[model samples]
Target chain A: SQTIHQWPATLVQPVGSPLSLECTVEGTSNPNLYWYRQAAGRGLQLLFYSVGIGQISSEVPQNLSASRPQDRQFILSSKKLLLSDSGFYLCAWISGGNTEAFFGQGTRLTVV
Target chain B: AQSVSQHNHHVILSEAASLELGCNYSYGGTVNLFWYVQYPGQHLQLLLKYFSGDPLVKGIKGFEAEFIKSKFSFNLRKPSVQWSDTAEYFCAVELYGGSQGNLIFGKGTKLSVKP
Candidate 1:
């Protein structure tokens, strides 16, 4: 069975501070990774997705960026956080040629 | 560009009531449709999906959805809903060979079932 791990489960950072959220998948290789944000009443919005290492496609332009450093490791980063950046961030993985996606326990980020 | 639309933003229903949540998509080519559920404090879980098969797809917890390509819609249904069914439901779409593994999601519908 594959599992996705995301941390920190909850984060509180001051405005203009740097932010880093990490997600890793175990028991799967070369899986498609994605970053999504769920804002209040906005539902889930895809931010970025990666097919392979060093290959990322951004869905929306925002203050955040995503990177796939390894086959199973994905990171979402922000050089400077904005108040609008606060939301519940989720990491998901899907196998190649598979339609169903598995999500990790999201990180609740609060940028004050 | 592709987009998904979920008709109801929120719905309240009594136990044993039927459910019919509407979902529509705007894409010219073949697309995959999906329904995901999220309980409070839980991660999003796949309820069901429609790729290529019989138009009607049944999922866990007595939920089903039918894909009507003619109307570009995939509507979720349940004959009887329980109070435990209260959760957020999302409709998503992925263009065949076009989405790049990204799924476009609709503004989810929050279903509150009263016991």
Candidate 2:
């Protein structure tokens, strides 16, 4: 069975602070990874998707970026946080060929 | 660009009641449809998906959905629902061979079932 793990289930930061969220998948290699944010009363917004290492696609333009340094590791980061950046962050993985994505627990982030 | 719509925003029902949630997509060509569930503290899980086969697909938790091409709807149904079925459900659509083939989710419908 495959499992996805995300760190710091909850976080709080001030505006202008840097941000980093970690996500790792176990039992799957070279999987397509994605980052999503669910805003209040809105649907999940795709922030980033990576097909392979050193490759990333930005779906929405914001103060955020994504990196896949390793095959099963994906990181979402920002040089500075904005209050609008506060939302529930989700990490997902796909089994390579257009498969349904599996999501992680999610991280609740608050920026003030 | 593609988008999804879930007609039900919130629904409240008692155990043993029938369940139905409406989902529709706006895309003319080929696409993949899906329904996902999110429990109180659990991650989102794939309840079911429809790519290119029979229109009706059964998923986990005794849930099933029918894809209607003419109506552009994929509504989920179950004869009876349990209290544990209380969760937020999402509708998604993936445009075939498009960049957004990943997923474009609907706002979501929150279902509350009482025992």
Candidate closest to the true structure, highest TM-score:
1
For all candidates in order, the CA lDDT equals 0.93, 0.90
Clashing residue pairs, backbone N/CA/C < 3 A, model 1: none
What class would a CAPRI assessor give candidate 2's docking? medium
DockQ of each: 0.82, 0.64
* Per-candidate alpha-carbon RMSD to the true structure: 0.8, 1.4
Please provide, for model 1 over B1-115, each residue's C-alpha lDDT reduced to its tens digit, 9 standing for 90 to 100: 6789999999999999999999999998998899999998788999999999899999999999999999999999999999999999999998888757678889899999999
- TM-scores for all candidates: the values are 0.98, 0.95
lDDT of 1 by residue, A1-112 (tens): 8999999999999999999999999998889999999987888999999999999999899999999999999999999999999999999997666678899999999999
Which stretches in model 2 have alpha-carbon errors above 4 Å? none
How large a fraction of the reference contact set does each model reproduce? 0.80, 0.60
lDDT of 1 at B21: 99
Any idea what lDDT model 2 has?
Answer: 0.90
Error of 1 at B110 (Å): 0.3
